[model samples]
Target: MTFSWRRRRSGRGGDGKSEVFKGINQDMELTIPTHFRCPISLDLMKDPVTLSTGITYDRESIEKWIDAGNITCPVTNQVLRNFDQIPNHSIRKMIQDWCVENKSCGVERIPTPRIPITPYEVTDIRSRIVAAARVGDARKCQELVGKIKDLAKESERNRRCIVGNGIGSALADSFESFARFSVDAHVNLLKEILAAFTWTFPLDEEGISKLKSAVSLRCMVWFLKSENDLSSRQNAICVLKELISADQACVDGLMGIQDIEETLFHTVKVPICPKATKASLVIIYNMIKSSKEKSGEIALKFIRMGLIHLILEILVDGDKSVCEKALGVMDSICSLEEGRENAYENALTVPLLVKKILRVSDTATEFSISSLCKLCLGENESALVEAMQLGAFQKLLVVLQIGSGERTKEKVTELLKLMNLCRDKVDCVDASMGFKYIKRSN
Candidate 1:
C-alpha cells in the first residue's frame, strides 16, 4: 500500500497541491519519501554522503563498502576517482525536518554524526605513546594504548587516518622500548600494546624490524604461553607471523628461544582458533624457509616436535583455507633433504599428499604436487611405488588436463614419466595395500 501526505499552499501561483511521497510502513501506515532513502540500505539516510559518481549513501554503509576494498560507486558501478566522502548537509537537514514533522508517526530524528578524526590528531596520539614508552611509564603507556584502540574502533575513517599517520611503526617502536621494564609488573601493558597493534596490521619494514627484536620475540612467546585470554594469544601469534617474515635472520632469533617452537607446535596440535592455527603454520613455513644452515636446523627441530604428524592430520580435517596453509608448511619443510627423508618414511605422508591434489585450491594443489615430487625423486623406490598405488598418477593426470603453471606442468610431466617408467613394479604392488609405513632410519 502507498502512503502519502499532500498539503495545500495558499499563494498566487500555487497549484493548490503539495508533493507526495511513496513509502511503506506496515504497522504505522506511514509513507517515506523515495529521495530521502539511501540507495544501499533502502532506509532513510541518517548521515548522507555523496560519492564522486553523484550517488548518495549513508556514511556507515558507504564507508564499510569502501573499506571492504571496493573502488566502484555502489549504485552506478563507476570507478571512484578518489575515496573522499562529501557530506550531504542539505539532505541530512531535510531528513531531520521530515522526521520531526512525522513525529506522530513514530519517526525519530537521527543525531548528527561526529566528524571523523584527523591525521594531525593521530600523530599527536602516536607521540604520546612514544613518550610514555621512553620514560618507562607503564601506567601511562597502557592508558594511551587503550585510547588508541578505542579511537581505531570508532570508524573506518579514523583507522585509515591513523594508519596513514604511521601508528604501526610507533606502536612497534614503543613495544620494543618496553624491554627495560619488568615483565611481571607490565604484563597488562604489553598485552594492551599487542591488542592495539593488531589494529595497525600490515606494518612497514621498519615496524617489522622493531617488532622482531630479541626482546619482543621473547615477550611474545611468553604471552602465547601465559595469557589466559585467547584473543591476546592470537594477536601475539599474528604479530609473530609478520616479525618472522621480516627476514631470514628472524628465524635465528627464534631458535635461541627453546620453548617458542614447542609453544607453536602445541598451538597447532590443539588449536584455540582457526586463525591462530593458520598463523602458526605460516610461522613454521617461514622458519623452515630460512637460510640454508638455519633452515635445516629449524626444520629438524619442528619435525622432531611432531609437526609433520599434525600437518598430515590437518590435511584430512581442516577446511580448504587451513589445508592450504598446512600444505605450504609441508612444502617448505620438504625442500630440505632430511625433511624429504622424514616425509618418505611416514605412511600418512603419501596418502595425505595425494588426497590434497586438485581437492583444495590451486595453491594447495601446487604445494602438494611439489612436496610429492621431492619425496618421490629420492632414492626410496617404495615412495614412488606408494605414490602409484595411492592414485597419485590419476590425480596428476587430471591436474595436467586442467592446466597448470609452467613450473607445475614441468613437475607433473617429470613425475608422470618416472611413474610410467616403473609401471611393471606398480602393477605387481597390492591394490588393497591401505598404507605403506616405512619406519624412519636411525
Candidate 2:
C-alpha cells in the first residue's frame, strides 16, 4: 500500500486543514474521478488495496470488511481464497501524483503506505522465538515478543501472517520445550509466550494438533498455578482456551495428568478474568467430550473439586456466552452416575437446569434437556420431586406442545415415562395427550 508522499494538501489560508483533495474541493463536494475513489467509501482512497477478485478499495475500509468475518469479496460477492489483500501500489502512485499536480490548489500528498510484515518474515522471527525459548534466554524472548507485538500492531494482515506462518504452533512447541528448563525459566518463557498471544495470533489446526504433548499440557497447568505473573496466567488461560477448542485429541492426552482436575477447578473457582473463566469451562467440556467412561471419571474428579457448585455460581452471574458454556459442561458432567448423584443432591441443580431451558439460546436448551434426561430417567425420587415442585412438568408440556426440536422432544418423552412409572405418587405431565414415548432422534 506504498504511495508517494512528496505532494501536499492545500489548506484554506493557513487553517491547517485539508480543503483540497487532489482536484476535488472538500467543501464543494465535486464529483471526483471514480477510479481514484474507494468503492467502499465512495471517496478518494488514501491507501487503495486490490483484492484477489480485482476490486480496489481504501485500505481501512477493506480491512474492516475482512475483519467483520466476511469471506466473500464485497463488490463481487465471490468466495475469497484467502483474506490477503494485495497493495495496488500503482493506483496509489497515481493518486499521489494527482495530489502533487493539484498541490497549487491546496491538495496534500498522502504518506507512503506502511507495509505489513510478510509470512516469511513472521516465520523467521517465530523460529527465533522458539530458539530463544529453547535456551531459556529471558532477554531474547522478551525482544522477540516485542518484535511480534510490533508486527501484530502494524495491520490485521500481519496478525493473519503470524498464524499462517505457524507462530502459534511455535509458541505451543516453545511452551513444551521450556518445561525442560528450570521452573523460573519456564515461567519467564511462558510469560513471553502469553505476551505474544495478547495480540491473538490465531492458532491453526496443525498448531493445535502439535500442542497435544504431555509436556505442553503440564505447562498449561503450571501457568494456571503461577503465583507471580497474573498477566501471563490470564494469557495462558486464553491460549489454553483456543488450544483446547481446536482438537479433542489434545484434550484426550491431558487426561493422564492426575493433577489436572485441581488445576482446572481452581481455574474455574477463581478465574483471573472473564476470558480465563470461559476458558476454564471450555477446557472441562473438552475433557468430557469423548467417552462416557471418561466422562464419568472426569465427573467424579470435578465433583471432588466442587466444580458443580462453582458452575452454578457462574451460571447465575455469567453473561450469555459463559452461561451457555457452563450449561454445556453441566450437561456432560451430569451424564454419569456420579455426576447425577452429585447434581441431585445439590439444591440449586434442578431449578437452575429448568431456568436455563429457554432462558438462553437453543444450544443451552439442548444441554438442559440432555442433563434433565440423565437426571430424571431413573428412580431418583429426590430429582423427580424437585422437578415436580419446580414446575418442570408444565415446562415440558409447553415444550412438546409448542414444538421443540425432534431430539429434545424425544428426551422429554423419556422424562415423562420415568415420571409416569411413579404416576401413582406424583402428578406429572399428563400422558393423556396421547403422547407416546418416542425414541430420541440422533
TM-score of each: 0.80, 0.75
Instruction: Summarize candidate 2's per-residue lDDT along 1-442 as a digit string, tens digits.
Output: 3222332334435454423354434443333467887778766788888888888998888888887988898889999987777889999999898777766656678877788777778878888977887776767877777788777777776777676787877776666666656546556656676667655546766556555677776676677788666777787777777766666666677778778778778878877888888888888887766646553576677776778888888888788889999999999888777878887788888999988877887788888888988888757777876776677777776777777788898888777656665555555545454445445436
Number of clashes in model 1? 0
List the global CA lDDT of all models: 0.79, 0.74
Which segments of model 1 are wrong by more than 4 Å?
1-30, 38-43, 49-97, 100-111, 246-249, 291-295, 428-442
Which candidate ranks first by lDDT, i.e. highest?
A: 1
Error of 2 at 306 (Å): 2.1
Q: Give the TM-score of candidate 2.
A: 0.75
* Residues 74-108, model 1: lDDT tens digits: 88999999988889989889988988897665556
Instruction: Return the lDDT, model 1, position 245.
Output: 59
